[model samples]
Target: MSGELLLVGSIPLDTPEDVFRTFGEPLGKYLFAMPDGEVGPRRHWISRVHYQVLAAHPELEVVQRPAPDENGVERQQPRNAADAWWFKVRDGIDRVRFGDPGWRLGYARDAVNSYFVFRTMKEKGVLPSHLRFQVSIPMVNSVLPPRIFPNRKDIDKVRPGYEAATRAEIAKIVEKIPASELAIQWDCSTELQDAYGAIAGYPLEGAIERNLIEVRNLSPHVPREVALGYHFCFGTLGGWPRFAPDDLGQAVKLANAFVAASGRPVDWIHIPVLDRSDDLFYAPLRELQPQGARVYLGAVHNMPRFEKRLATARKYLPDFGLGAYCGFGREPTSELPNILNDHLRAAQIAAL
Candidate 1:
């Protein structure tokens, strides 16, 4: 409930250069710069080490990866974006199977996502008994199923099994956590950015409304008292475009419109507050009250300096939280800390 807090994307698993040197050739060139994300002994150990460092902060909380598949879908547990897109194509196909007509597999996949995260946290010893356990589902940007299954058209259309699959997943995760400790966050990568316009199977408004519907749908499935948050922003990976929603003001307006339409209450709307060049929307942002919507404007960047970055946050003033800007500052490691401090400062200044 306090504003003086630290929020971060997942820590990168350390994949040393030497480890990649053994792989040899052109492949070796790729190894030196990859992020050692959650996977394997080294990453697990890195989390442990960082956990200890973060332990003393009192205000810091680390979002860690869930356990590996018991079914063995992952190979070596890649560290970082070294292979983030490694399964992009395959995943598309996998979801398509149940995606057609009745969303036969949508709910199933959603359930698996929760279970996998719960189990992964269990294995890593990262699921702190007294911590805020945040698990992000790739709703708009990444996890959405294909637009169609040409041959059939019964239930595969809307939201896979509609909200049934999502609710089931929500229920399962809540059951795993104690009533007092339950927290779930919807990672809405594909909300209202403008780029979604270019890649259209669903209209921009339609796409957004549907996703919000999913969020509202999932809410009742979880405990009434548990905290729910929505994270949104423009994103990119490996220098390639990932997604593009509209500007901050546009997003704010759209959100207000969406909320008005849905009539649901979301505890937090976590957004990229600082670092964006567009400053056209705060008036609009300010116009919309946080009566039911508490805006966590992301101010953090991947940079390390505190004062300079925190100043950036104050400059934005009640606008954003520094987070996942261009997908967590994908190019540099030093930027993360700076970005994070900016976010914390926003929370501090925003009284949120």
Candidate 2:
């Protein structure tokens, strides 16, 4: 069977028009959905918006600033500590309450604006009419990560307000876009990191449960008619493959938990595949129970590794879509064509 393609969000293009012309135009046939490349500030993912939100909060303070490297140059923000800022609950503030942080997250506004370009492209016959305009939103914990908050207590205190704001963002997006033409993907990088015991100063105990709680809370906000999906990410904040587990056991367990906890029908689930193809690594996929949701494996990075990974994955999954481990927004613009080519090649291989 010819497997479908999943663009895990951001396409690294300059504009929605550019993304529709360059990415959606050529790959629309293979793609079930595509994003506007998360152009402008969103190219940095949640950090750009999160920083603005956190910075404006009275109870929070920027405690750490990017330190100069050995070369005396500050690194780019959000990629690593070089260009990032850390926040903490103000010393005098006994409790942190972001009561209506009084700003928009920019997701809903961007999605509505980009959808215009998406629809235009489709009308021009540049993109397939069946393609849904994907809108990827980070889980609250992902946006306010332990790395940024550095305090679990502070995150607990701040999460409710942030989550409420996130839900509102979803509400706005759904209100404006037709459910059938929209797909909402909740990016779960930080949750997966915590589940893997990868986050510092955070206990791994109940991490999966915590993630499920958040999933249950956020999933219902997405209208039943709107396609809902979860992108189970290991993260790419500092670098790719943030957590290289010996096997897919933990990921599979987490995926199962997410599917079970989500109140509505999850249209799809995306799990990142490592570069290695060891049977031991992909073995836990045998335990996956998607519950009717389409499964997409992130197995399109290295062609050679992809072939081997796909072979191993097929032993258990049998059938699934293909995608990169995460979005291409962080990559240089020059590399997008190659990334697009990789997806095309993987699709061809999957068909074979």
Candidate 3:
């Protein structure tokens, strides 16, 4: 069977409608569904969501610290310095408490708006009839405490409120949007951290099993009727992977772990294949047993070696869809069309 196309959330576009109109065909032709392209300021995804959450609760205070480089070198810079906003988070145990958190949480409202746009585009013939609206969410474990709280005690104190608020936000979405047209993807960049045994204070002894439990807990909330999927990520900054894998072994193992634990039918699972990936990088996929969940490999990139990468990927596991390593929101706006074009080209090559 030919592989379908999957968009791992954001597309750098002016609006959701534009994303549908511009790439809908190349997408509709090969994709099973379409995301709203995470248009507007939300192109920053987690950061934007964090701002919204902080804005609603005046109790929380934005705390800043020196920015740490990939090498752990602390750089003294302006709070608003390049990529410095990611490290700022509201820190206060009392303020972190969610008192009957409501619609003000942001994510549900965004998903609802995106779904309306999707429905409109579908009615106007921009999106295909069968296209389900994709709602991508960064897991609370990956977002809160980790990004916001550096102190382990602070993480323990704050995580409950943040998690409750997140669930409330999702509950709001489920209340509004029809389950049949919704697909919830829990983006897992921290899973890579778990795989590498690098999650600081978090014990890696049972990290894989712990990650599986998180997925299982979140998956059940989606309702068996709705589509639930996992995107095993390696972090992304400026459209580039944060960590290059030595092999897909860790990702493959986690994918299988999730499949075995998630009880509900996972409509799909996306795995990233970086620019430098070769057969060795993909060989571990031979152990990937998704049971029956569709696999979408993040094998698309802006390179002439597209066919070569796809061919190497096929050698280990031939049936899978196409996607970028992560969202293209951080990339130049001008690169959007070219990225779509690359998807089309990669899709063609995969068919051969």
Candidate 4:
């Protein structure tokens, strides 16, 4: 039987100036069953790495562009998750791939995800108290252009421009999408410490420091009902950082982690446990308890078949509404669907 579509609560929205104007309003969204209004200027920034990589490896186009980054120029890349497209690269000398203004899935997907929610509400004439979404992986700073902390006069304005642009983009989402429909899940990928420091030569402490600051800024703009959750894990980026990542145990001990108000401790953690056929991190994961929130030990890893997936989920998190995790496998093109399916299956099993 063909499986039904499962909702993935998280997706990146394509930001343009017009979209920013709608923050906290009902009628600003061009997509999503929003407050309502006229369509705003559509701005889809080109995915630089996707085009370049797609051109170089047409076969992997299905996977997505494995973006390029300067060893230390600035910006961050999307590591592990099913859809972290490469946004920029450092070392301006390379001309290895092409980028395009088209290929806009975020815009399309934003509309699609929003329509699902909005349409349902329309039919029933009911609106949800809050619109929940996974905010973009706020962890990757290396992929972005350097936003020198102090703002240097000699440096190119790329960082500041992107920073303003990003704010405006979020602002747009804020103005248009009602505060009632917003909750954020900050995916800090497991590798908040060592991996990033080693790979991009970014200071782990500084990176974590920066991330928390961003979160603090984002929190004020969000509604009180908007649940703010963090997904922490040791991430694998660029397909170069080897797979088989682990819990951010080493990193968690650092000050970067803040205990939530509830009492559990160890920073907000989410580790990929079930991969291929093994629940590698299950036993070790039990020790993780972040005070304010709960950590979901990844019950199913490496996307599983329908039967095994269900059996395994029941085995791990039978009483929770947590997500499933199957670490990246093979390549992005082929694996994302399987990963997505695992997410769908998890959602289905949860409902049952």
For each candidate in the order shown, give its overall lDDT on alpha carbons: 0.40, 0.82, 0.73, 0.36
- Which residues of candidate 4, in runs, are more than 4 Å off? 1-161, 189-197, 203-207, 233-243, 246-248, 251-270, 274-299, 303-320, 324-352
| Candidate 1 residue-wise lDDT, 1-352, digit = tens | 3323323233432332221221111121211111112223223222222222222322222223323466956433223333321111221232222123322323223333434554454355433223444444344223332321222232133334434545655565566555454445555544545324534455555655545565555555657566665556554432433444344565565556444543345555665544444445333455554456555555444334434544544545544333333234243556534543444454454453
Per-residue C-alpha lDDT of model 4 across residues 89-111, encoded as one tens digit per residue: 33342322222321221232343
Using TM-score as the measure, the top candidate is 2
Candidate 2 lDDT over 4-57, as tens digits, reads: 888888877778999888878777898878888888878878777656677777
For candidate 3, what is the lDDT? 0.73
The segments of candidate 1 whose C-alpha lies over 4 angstroms from its true place after superposition are 5-8, 14-131, 145-158, 194-207, 240-246, 257-264, 302-352
Per-prediction count of colliding residue pairs? 36, 0, 0, 46
- For model 3, state the Cα shift of residue 219 in Å: 1.0
lDDT of 3 by residue, 41-138 (tens): 66766666555565345555556544687798854332332343333334433436676554655678778988888899889887778877888888
TM-score of 2: 0.93
TM-score of every model? Answer: 0.54, 0.93, 0.87, 0.48
TM-score of 1: 0.54
As a whole number from 0 to 100, the lDDT of residue 195 in candidate 2 is 82
In model 4, what is the error at residue 110, expressed in angstroms?
4.9
Off by over 4 Å in 3: 1-3, 55-59, 65-95, 99-102, 145-147, 200-203
